[model samples]
Target: MQETPFTLRAGHLLPYCMSDSNKTDFTNPSTFILLGIPGLEAAHIWISIPFCTMYAIAVLGNIAILFIVRREPSLHVPMYYFLCMLAVTDLVLCMSILPKMLSIFWFNSREIDFNACLTQMYFVHCVSVIESGIFLAMALDRYVAICDPLRHSIILTNPMVAKVILAVVLRGSMIVLPYPFLARQWPYCRTNIIPQSYCAHIAVVKLACADTRVNSYYGLFVLFGVLGLDAIFIAMTYIQILRVIFSLPTKDARLKTFGTCGSHLFVILAFYIPGLFFSLMYRFAQNVPLHFQVLFPNMYLFIPPMLNPIIYGMRTKQIRDRLLRLFTHKGP
Candidate 1:
């Protein structure tokens, strides 16, 4: 007897290929088959083009940001320190997914070791949690700079930023640490083929015959705890910053003050909006079209890392001047 190769379970489009043996109990497969994009397999090559381009930009841009920030002593401060954290987090986040995904698309390498898939799943969510915290940190930097300019330096010292980063890392790591462990315990007999291009927790755990609601619940908890709480705090910080900016005495003063934050706000929006959309789409929007489901998550992952360095390079005058000087080989 055979079961349907795929099904819509709680809005996930995972295809579970049943083994002919169809053992009723749990069995761990040595590897899982990664189908790049289930419904859009024909366009995998075309899709890889843009994904590869974005990955290249993410790598080069973030490395440049790190190099420029580190080389120029004048650029060393809480703001840039937090930015370095952001660069590192973005680098890790993109690397966790894009390389494997590209391999699937380009080389037709789809068989990922089960343990390796769990590792990917763990880092994918872990770094994402770290990214959200970095954004919150960035928002805090801007908030203090704008609202309490006189004490900004004192309030956000290098030591303080170090502590904050430590907290962010620890919290993100702790929150997501259980994911792979919990995933490992689940008994899988349903299918080894995950519909998504990458090894997401939901994509993998859904294959288990045992009840996976615990995994799902904990995933939700992490979403709200890290991304959700961090987002709320960021919004609140920006609101206070806006209040201070508008209170400035002159038109140029207002514009200039707000300009300092404009790029950050743009970056935050770029990071959060699509992410939240994808998160909700998967949780609630069951009947959403398949291509969109496949495409949007990849876009959400690919766009932010590529854009962050470009945004800071163009928008922050200090970084921009430094980049120009670095490129022109002009000594200040």
Candidate 2:
């Protein structure tokens, strides 16, 4: 007579390979596997090249922005200080996903060790929080400049701006740290497949062996906590800005103030709104093509960094003039 093998409720089977007499659940091997992008060999060759090129561009562009800010003394101010931090976050974000992401795309090896996968998750959330915080700080800078011009110098002093920058990064880190920790606690079965280009929080959360009700709550908290709070604060700041602008008697003054903030406002909306929509679409919409998931994250993560320099260059006469002078050796 054959003995029955015990089953683990989470779609996991106890050691069925061993001799029935010697088999024991206590010594059963449990290992996680990554079901990376489907249709492996074709995907590997077709997808990896473009993704790698993008990664290189993201890293190099942000680094160039950082260098320009550092070398140009005239660019030193609260706004550019915050801009530098934004670039730093982008650079870190690209670094977090790119190396392993390229490896996955090019090589047939889809095996990411538990620790490594978790580490990537940690960075994805951490830098996302940092980006939000930086945006909030930029909004605050605009608010101060517009609402209280006379006090702007006093309010945003050198030492003060430095301290605030530090606070923003630290605060963001503290808030996002919990998500990865909670995510890591869940026991993953062997078939832990993530369908995206990178280790997204939602993608990882879907792999929990235990009920993800708790994780869903945490995920909501993260969604609302980071994105929600920042959006509200930014909206309020801009509202105040609008009120201040309307109060200005001179057309020229209003135009100048609007010109100063226009680029930042556009950048913020470009970065946040599409991302929020994408998140909603992913969660609510069923049978979403894998490409949509793959495309949106890249748009939010990569596009903003690339757009920052371009937006600032086009809108700000200074950057445009400088570029022209460098290229054409002509006067603005």
Q: Identify the leading candidate in terms of TM-score.
A: 1
Candidate 1's C-alpha runs over 4 A off are 1-26
Residue pairs with colliding backbones in model 1 are none
The 10 consecutive residues of candidate 2 with the worst lDDT sum are 1-10
**RMSD, one per candidate, in order:** 4.6, 8.1
Error of 2 at 176 (Å): 1.7
Q: In angstroms, how far off is 188's CA in candidate 1?
A: 0.6
lDDT of 1 by residue, 215-303 (tens): 87887777666687888999999989989888889999999988988988998888777777677666667677766766667766878
Off by over 4 Å in 2: 1-50, 320-332
Global lDDT scores for all candidate models: 0.79, 0.67
Query: How well is each residue in 16-117 modelled by candidate 2, as lDDT tens digits?
Result: 223333232321123233433433436666666666666677676667567666756777888988988988888887787767666766664555766676
TM per candidate comes to 0.92, 0.82
Candidate with top lDDT is: 1
